[model samples]
Target chain A: MKMKCTISYDGHLFNGYQVQPGKRTVQAELEKALAILHKSEDKVPVISSGRTDSGVHAAGQVIHFDTPLSIPAERWPYALNALLPGDIAVKTAEHADDGFHARFSAIKKEYRYFVYTEKHPDVFKRHYAYHFSYRLNVQKMREASEHLIGTHDFTSFCSANTEVRDKVRTIYELDWTDTDDGLQMRIVGSGFLYNMVRIIAGTLLDVGTGKFSADDVKGMLDAKDREAAGRTAPGHGLYLWHVYYDN
Target chain B: MKMKCTISYDGHLFNGYQVQPGKRTVQAELEKALAILHKSEDKVPVISSGRTDSGVHAAGQVIHFDTPLSIPAERWPYALNALLPGDIAVKTAEHADDGFHARFSAIKKEYRYFVYTEKHPDVFKRHYAYHFSYRLNVQKMREASEHLIGTHDFTSFCSANTEVRDKVRTIYELDWTDTDDGLQMRIVGSGFLYNMVRIIAGTLLDVGTGKFSADDVKGMLDAKDREAAGRTAPGHGLYLWHVYYDN
Candidate 1:
């Protein structure tokens, strides 16, 4: 049976969504739990919608896995949750069509970056938000965000060592608003290259700080060079808010 | 100068209030920070109104420190906050009369404990709440709270390891209220011995669960033995709500 699972996780303790040696990764933890249920070391290969870096949390990370054991879809969430760690939770699980792939079938993904401009450190909110005591001009950041929308070669806004040849990606939406805790920057795109969302967030922050004009993003995009992008924001502030898939 | 400081801290990372060797205690952290400020090998001891256990948190824990430094007492909050770690912050600092003391001059201390009765684990709230899936009777808990008013020899409620010779402590008020998030137990007392608040909370929880009657608390208090009290609740769900002091 092929199962589609929606999960939420606190990424601070994890190396990343991907499994790596000597580090406690989210995939490895989930895989270990799945192995216990199936009674086989290689019973399932869990596939996620995308790789989220360490300290990048998720509210809804879509994933899929195949199992030889027969288990009701309704019981999947409860069964998996019992074996998973405290930081991760299986929110929903159901049977997906045979052709569906958690990654390839996705049409769009939404990411949110949270930042707070407060002098005192928020004791309860430190894990979920990045504190930037410096005052920011949101109007300028919004102006810069407009230039980031639409289809363009985002090579300038990606990590230098990214292997993807197609640097072109369509950003469906880019907006920023003041939330109760801090400023929340939301970006929805068909696909993203390595560090694209974080780079965009950093660039917007630069604009907000008046370090660069909104037009600078245009020049950076025109250059199509990784060095042209702003500094990458720390992964802790980023969240995989949601995933959109074609019906 | 006598300085009054309001400290906010995440208690999960420390071993309760008092300074102890080989342990990371809140008092030790503050003393270390104060030592750095004073440029003295000798630690600056700060007296706190509330001495909470490990894993408990405080949004505002009142404390007083005496120092010969010429800095105004009003600047103590900002100055201490600048030197403290990210986990601890001094919210406000004020000058207190020489007669003022955080512990002896305190009139009342309020504590709040949160419990979640839902089946699902709240990832965001895991550190601050105790999760139990059982159905709780709030009315029963509230009714039971009435038995815990005024002064009493709380030997049954206090832990055996406490160094305090007298078991008599006045609990001014104790009540339970249901919130959108969970059940909140609030207790106001002149002072609390080791594990007294947690034991009271545990006893009230027992009443909520129909294991004991509200009137049974009378017998428990009369017993004056630690074994007669209900189990001690975990420390994570408790918070030092507020402290009132007389100048």
Candidate 2:
């Protein structure tokens, strides 16, 4: 049976979500927990809604793992959390239809990037946020984000190593808000390529810093080349906020 | 010449305040920053008020580094912070009397340990605090802290490997308070042996959990055996809050 789970994890310790032989990854951790719980040496395959890079955190990372245990779905979260480390926690768990796949079934994904621009670095939130010394123009960044909405070729913002042939993807919404903590950039999209969100964040940061304008983003989108965009932002600031799947 | 400086550090990235070969430490980083500013590799020797374990944090950690840069003492914090990494910052710097030393001139040291006594863990504060799932009796902990006040032989609460023969120490204050964030334990002492604060925290935690009585602390103190005390608390939750040096 397919068991779907909503997980929250501190990605700073892992290379990424993907399982590697020697590295400590989130998937590997989950599989280890499952193996221990089920008393089986065979590894259980778990699928995530998205692949997050190293240092990228998640509050609503969705995943699914198939298990032979006939345990009730509601008990999964408490059971999993009991075995997982303090860094990872399962907020909710439920059984899904056999056809449900965490990644391919997702209709939309929302991501948020946090930046701390305060003069004094936060003693508590140093790891969970990105500290930028210079002030940023939220209005300018919002203006640039408009050019990012809608279906278009995101090649300029995508990682060069992305194997996806079609560079086109739909961005349903783009929002920016500044709070007491820092500037928050929230982007919702139907799909995102490798390093796509971070590059877009970097480009928007360029606009916020007055180095570029909204038109520059449009120009880069038209160019459809990775070199046309700004540098990729640090992964630590970005988070996989939510995932939407059509029933 | 003694240059008295107030230093601030994240402390998560460092092994401790002391300098050790092949390890990145707070004192080592400060010395490196001074070396760059002074244009010589081994010119500055850094000394700190106390040594904090790896994963421990500090805000008003005092240190002194001698330099011949001729920079005004008041401007030293600004000068050194610019040269240091994001994790470490110099809060204040001042010239001191010839015999003034950060470690030797210290009269009292204050430390704080943050505990999150919740059913689940806080993702952002995972590294910043110790998460105790069981309920902690704050009143009980505070009541027990009263027993720890004043001068006493704290041999039971000292680390087993401590080299200091003198087990007698004066605890100026010991208290616990409940905050919106979590529980905080504050301790001030004239001087502490190795792992003394952590051991005290551990013993107090046992009192909080109803495992030990407030009056039991006196017997433990009188026993002078390490086995009479509670388990040693993890180092990550401890923070060297500040050090007082008699001017």
Candidate 3:
């Protein structure tokens, strides 16, 4: 039987979401716990909707796995959560259609990047937000983000190491909001490339700090060169906020 | 010159707030940093308003120390913060009157205890809150807390090993509020005994879970015995919220 699970994790502990030998990773931990439940030495593979970089958190990451146990959907979370570490938790579990795939069937994803603009760092949120003491013009950042709100080739914003041939992706929304703590940027899209969200955040921050203008951002998009875009923001400030699928 | 400083710390890393031989403590760190500023091999003693146990955090802990440096009050934070670890930070610093004392001159203190009642723990707050899966009746807890207010001999709520001769203390406010994340208990008092707040939290938790009633709490208070109260809640869930003093 195929099961779909939604999970939330504090990503500070894991190396990343992908499985690697001898390294602690989210996928490895999930598989290890599942294997323990099955009482087998062999690895039990679990598929995630997407991979998040090291130190990046997730509030609604989706995963799918095949299990031989006859546990009910409601009990699956309880049964698995008991074996998983405190940093990772299975929020919900449900039966999925046989044809459903966690990654291929996803229609949209939302990512949020947090930046703390205060002069002094917040002790509690230190690990979760990028502490940049520079003053930011929220209006300029909003103006710059407007250019990013539609389907376009995002090669300039993607990491240089990405091997994917297609660079086009649809961005449904790109906006910023001032939270009580700091600035939060929300970006929703059909798909994202390697390091795309971080690069976008960094570029917008430059515009916010008066280093660049909205027109400069549009020129960078047209350049189609990774060097034309701003640096990639740190992964610790990023969060995989949500993932959506068409039923 | 004497300096008064307000500091906040993530106490998970320190053994406690006081100076103990061969232990990583907040006082030791502060004194060591001060010694470096003074260029002395001898330890520079710091006086804090009070000590916090291991894993207990603080947001507004006040302290006073005598220094030989002529650095401006505004620059003290910048200088000291550079030497302190990431977990500890000096929030503000200012010159204090000669008669001021961090411990003796303080008129009031506020402490907060956080309890996460959900079955699943919050990933972000796991380090700061106590995860209690049992259902809690807030009204019952509030009723029981009312008996604990006003001046009373808090011997039952204090740790047995406490050497302080006086067991009497005044609780100005003992109230609980429901937050978006969990239930938080705010306790304001003229002073607190060793482990008094934790014991009170545990007793209130008992009342919340139907293990004890408001009348039972009154009986325990009247009993004036350590064995009469509930267990001390874990130290990690407690926070020194603020310390008050007259200028």
Candidate 4:
């Protein structure tokens, strides 16, 4: 039987989500804990919905693995959490349908980024929020987001080194709200390419700072070139907020 | 001229606020940064409002130092912050009156403590908030705080090893509010004894958990013995919120 788990991890503790040689990664840690629970020398492979880059956090990341052990669903979180490090936690665990796949079965994903707009760095939020002192016109950024709300080819908003050839993706929602200390941008989409969220966050800053007008977003979308958009925002400010699967 | 500076720091990086022989400390960092700004071989001493133990955060900690440089008041924050480490920051700096002292002249001080009530630990807030899963009765805690208000000898709330002979202190206000995540207690007083706020927080938990009643607080005060009170809450949960001075 396949088991599904919802996990939350602080990105600062790990190198990234994937397994890397001689580096501490979230996947390696999870598997090592699972191996101990399973009482097996051979590690149980855990599959994640997606990989987050170094310094990118995830609160609602989904993962799945096949297990022979029949631990109750309610007790799985307690069992796994005991072995997991302080930076990672298993929030929920339950049996998944045989058809369910952690990544392939996901219908939508949400990504959120935090930008601290204050001129002075906030001591408490230095690790979680990206300190961006640049002047931002939120109205202009909102206007620019309106143009990219629907299905579009987001080649210009993803990294040039993205492994995926197809860049067409549906962005269901793109919203930004002014928080007390900074700005929070939440984007929901069918799927994302490599560095897609970070690039979009960076490109929106150009429109917000008056370098590129809201109208230029349409032109950049048409160009389908990586250079047409702005710089890629840092990974430290990005969080994989949620993943949705059809009921 | 004597310059006053309001500083903020994440106490996780410091051993304590005071300058120790070789351990990293908030005062040591501040003075080291100031020594570079003064361009002198001798360390420019930085005096703070009071010493906070290791892992106690401070957002409005005031410091004072006599400086020979003629930097503008507006430029002091930038000048000092540039030289300080990431964990410590100078929020504001201005020329203080001849008699103003960071510790001696302060009229009142506010200390805030955060308690996370969730059964599971929060990954992001681990450094800032104390994780307490014990059942808490906010109303009972509030009633207990009423007895602590006004002039009283807080000998029972302070550590027994405290060097100060006099333990009498006046609490202007003791307020606890239920936040979304947990409970936040803010205590304002003329001054605090060593570990006073933390011990009060711990003792209030006894009241909140039914180990003691609201009326017992007065008896604890009358006892004037540290053993009469409950345990000390962890230092990481406490924050020196602000200092009130006569304008």
Return the top candidate by lDDT: 3
Report the error of model 4 at residue A43, Å.
1.1
Question: DockQ, per-model, please?
Answer: 0.51, 0.26, 0.66, 0.66
User: Highest TM-score, which number?
Assistant: 4
Error of 2 at A72 (Å): 5.0
Models ranked on TM-score: 4, 3, 1, 2
Span of 10 residues, lowest total lDDT, candidate 2 chain B: B118-127
Measured with C-alpha atoms, the lDDT of residue B98 in candidate 3 is: 92
Name the regions of candidate 4 deviating beyond 4 angstroms: none
lDDT of candidate 1 over A174-195, digit per residue (tens): 9999976789999999998999
Predicted complex 2: CAPRI docking category? acceptable
Weakest 10 consecutive residues of candidate 4 chain B by summed lDDT: B117-126
Mark the 10 consecutive residues where model 1 chain B has the least summed lDDT: B118-127
- Give candidate 4's fnat, 2 decimals: 0.42
Worst 10 residues of 4 chain A by lDDT: A118-127
Ranking by lDDT: 3, 4, 1, 2
RMSD values, in order shown: 3.1, 4.3, 1.4, 1.3
Q: For candidate 1, write residues B1-247 as lDDT tens digits.
A: 8888888888888898887789998898899889999998997988998677889899779989889898876677667777887788887888888899888888988999889986667666678888866788889888778878899999999999978998898999898888888999999998888988899988889888888888888899999899987889888888998998764
The alpha-carbon deviation from the true structure for residue B205 of candidate 4, after best TM-score superposition, in angstroms, is 1.9
Q: Which scores higher on TM-score, 1 or 4?
A: 4
